[model samples]
Target: MSQVFEGYERQYCELSAILTKKCNSATILDGEQKKQKLSEIKAGLDDAEALIRKMDLEARSLPPNVKATLLAKLREYKSDLNNLKTEVKRITSGNVNQAARDELLESGMADANMVSADQRQRLMMSTERLNRSSDRIRDSRKTMLETEDLGVSILQDLHQQRQSLLHAHDTLHGVDDNISRSKKILTTMSRRMSRNKWIIGTIIVVLVLAILLVLYFKLAH
Candidate 1:
């Protein structure tokens, strides 16, 4: 019984160590990090399988209590493995590339043994942090895009305003030219009328003077 317990403890330690490494790898989502974690997980899983096999063999040689304990442990490992598979499915559901999927699968299986309550709590915290960071990055990118759109809209408005001002300036210039031309025509007509009036006044004074001279000569005769 003591020997069986020792083996179980060793198996638990090995599985826990591998799982810790896998969770750490998940913290790094880069290609190289994923690949390295995948390799480590595969190796760890192999070791775990070997330990389980040894435990199985020892089960047959142990007392009833030890046998029952080993069987229960086996079931726990199976349950952990199933959960690992499901986690892999979730991680790779976002149209991830083949290499990324492979790496996520490897890291997800690194800890396929029953975990302690403390370890579960830590894992949950880590997952939450990662999700929050991803959301923040997405929001920042969206704000930048909106700012760019606003800048483009303002630029278009300025361009239209500049065109309007230029058109107004051109129209005012044409009106000024027309007014100046009309003023010159009006001045020329006024000067011509003044000269005509002077010529007509001189002709009327000459005719009246001639009529007075003829009447005076006839009366004297």
Candidate 2:
């Protein structure tokens, strides 16, 4: 149960981050920015879907009541993501348009719609779905907190695991950095050594020539 909850927690955090990133990315009016955000949202959705499957499996193993609650939460999350997808589709398709473009806009049907009625209805739907999903996720989290045994021992164990993972990651990063620095240093040293060798060879050749010249002069005299 704890393991399943852990996975769900990670998924929830990822989804939240993706939502925040999408919102931030959407702030940029550029098409590139929008595309990037869209891609991120897709990836996030994929991760969420995978997590949902895992949760489903774990839920099957849980007590009937817990399983039912989790299943309900999962369904709500699925619905929410679906809604968001629809809204996003509408946005990409440019379903929203000027009032002059459609009579529905003047009739208030379009006005009631998100952003613009001319904008793809899919996109608007997606937005609504995401909002609902977020809400449900929050509710689910609260329920889990209240129902689950989130004692100090469990929390401390999780903290230790997190710390270990973080430390490992940092250590790997440090090693990579060290290796990069070492390579740079080695390259510099190799270049310097080559220069030094060239200089020494040149000096030796000059000395040899000088000695030969002196011998020749002495022999000639």
Candidate 3:
């Protein structure tokens, strides 16, 4: 049980650190990159929430204060997740506007007579904004991919460590079983030796009694 709690604590700390990094990464991003990061963040939050649920179930045996603290952290994490989702929705709406503008330009509907000077200026600005957004998204994606690769490597290392621990545990159990079997064999041998000693002592006493009886009979005669 202690081991379980310890494992949970370690996982929770790792998750918290990852979330903090992700949040920081999001702050440096904007437009589509921020939106994409938010999506990933939402997924991470889901995983975190699942862990919290597992912890909650297991923590029934823990101190009340400890359990309460865990619950509070979970709630806080959830609130942050909600805020991120809201941001995603806002970005999505902006993307829709950008898409509509692109569609109009592609369809040749943005003619000189149809759009005024002010409207053209606004369209140019939107186009430039989108171009910049795309560039940032590209850079952010590269960084995110690198971070993901690092995370995968860490997980693999952890998996290898877990396998090693399991192997060690199995080896220990095998040794324990061998020790138990040896103890049982020694107990059986000791019992057999004691039985043989008791039988030999009884035979000697019977032989002495028989000899004394014969001497008495011979003397009486």
Candidate 4:
């Protein structure tokens, strides 16, 4: 991967640190200040998400041999990012609930019907906000599930390839054993042919000597 991809990991860490600090101190800040800090946290989270996506793409572009390990690490970072986002959402939701409570408490002997209408409006707005946040969470969850499925499929392919390699290795070993057996059989046949040649030569020499003795006897007579 390029250095830009590597730098993204570090950048995410820095952004996460800043967001964590902001979240920790958010409760102590005044309402306006808390809203501003939440805005910054949301921006930082967006940057973190961008960095995560870049890292994932870079890791996936690596060769398969090394890609698995890098992808595992990337998944861990993604999980961390999910946790951070969840925390930020929780803080934002808590603020909404707190504001609703403060508004209810401050209404002080106001006209009952008007108070009811105002509270209902605020409740409707909060509900809409929650629904929007839920939709985003659902989308994120769906993407994560798809990524996990892809990883599982890759692992299965690698396993099948490993099984094929092992089967091929066994077949080559069997062929080598067959070759060795054929070599031994040919060696034994070659030795038997050599013995038969030596026996034939001995018989011919003996016959020639016998004929020579018979000729000598005829000449003497």
Candidate 5:
């Protein structure tokens, strides 16, 4: 009896998880992902329904709390399924409306060749509407041309400004290069000056040593 109740509890949990997953997937996924998720949801629902029926057969033996919980979960699952159905219907209906609109337009085009007076009237009205639309388009195109001319002028000004900026950047870079070269030249000159000072001091020391040696030799002689 305990094992039977545990099995029912596990099945209820599985159904609950499936319902939660289905609701989340429907809300978040779209296109092919949505379709795939919906299929999985349906499969889950089928499995849950089967499990519920099996549990129902043993309902008299089940504890009151377990039975109540199962009923509540089933109700919630039914509500979610209804909501999903409504969403699917809404999406499909919108597509149907669009398709109907397209078919109406196509039919109107075909009616232009029909011999009926009513059809001719509709054709005339459609033609007139098209002509008016063409006129408006022509006016819009003229306005667009004027706007384009203004845009071209603005673009030219922007191009000139960009060129000026580029020239300034180049000039600044040249100045930086010149400063760097000057620093290198000054460093080389300072190093040469230090070497020259060292050479001059060595020469002075050698000449002094030679003079002292000559004085000593002359005294000894």
Candidate 6:
């Protein structure tokens, strides 16, 4: 990811957590407190939305072929943003949320001193859950990065092995040529040795005949 996009994403993540807290805690919505809280959530939502726009800008700035993948991720983020928007809308309006709003307005009565103890506790628990979820997300991202690096290393090793195999193949091709040449040389030498043997046998036969004729002339005398 580009540094700009990463920055935008970091901001978005923080805002997302904040919005989650406000929207979830406001289950009982009412009065000035609920209105003020919703306004803050809306503000955060707007900022998150602006960041999403920036991220989209950054993503689209990439080359066409590369942008496709990032765009898909951006689409998912947009979906998430829409869900957050919907949740806030649902909490702030309609008959379903009207009573809860009244309850929250009443809770403010116990304020400045006590009564929000449970509310605070619930907020704490929500924060903890969000933190744990963030941790798991970070761990998953780390594992993915490690896996990608391992895959690259394996590809490099495979390429080197392929090159070595090609070199060995070339060497074997040369050896086959040498073997053929050696076979021809041996065949030529065998033919010459056979011809030389025949000439020696002819000379031996001629000498023996001349000796036999001389012996016969001596006996006649």
Q: Against the true structure, whose TM-score is highest?
A: 6
lDDT of 6 by residue, 44-160 (tens): 889989999999999799766445555765675676688779878877765555565566567633441242345335444544564565567668889999999999999999999
The residue-level lDDT of candidate 6 at 177 comes to: 96
lDDT of 1 by residue, 1-221 (tens): 34664566466555855565564445346567766666666566667666666767776677664466556555655555555545444443435666754664676344332344445555445435644654676588789999999999999999999999999999999999999999999999999999989999988899888999999999999
Candidate 3: residue 116 lDDT (0-100): 32
Task: State every prediction's TM-score relative to the real structure.
Answer: 0.45, 0.39, 0.37, 0.42, 0.33, 0.47
Worst-scoring 10-residue span by lDDT in model 5: 108-117
Between prediction 4 and prediction 6, the one with superior lDDT is 6
Off by over 4 Å in 2: 1-3, 20-28, 97-221
The clash tally of candidate 2 reads 19
Please identify model 5 stretches exceeding 4 Å from their true place.
1-147
The candidate maximizing lDDT is: 6
Ranking by lDDT: 6, 4, 2, 1, 3, 5
The collision pairs in model 5 are: none
- Steric collisions counted per model: 0, 19, 0, 0, 0, 3
What are the lDDT scores of the predictions, listed in order?
0.63, 0.64, 0.63, 0.71, 0.61, 0.73
lDDT of 5 at 133: 58
lDDT of 3 by residue, 1-221 (tens): 23464466457546655654555455445578877887887787677677656766765666664455445444544454455456445444544455645554465243422333343355345435644655676688789999999999999999999999999999999999999999999999999999999999999999999999999999999
Residue 201 displacement (Å), model 2: 99
Q: Can you give the lDDT of residue 122 in candidate 1?
A: 57
Give model 4's TM-score versus the native structure: 0.42
Better of 1 and 5 by lDDT: 1
lDDT of each residue in 82-107, candidate 4, tens digit only: 86687678667765465644553465
- Tell me model 3's lDDT, rounded to 2 decimals: 0.63
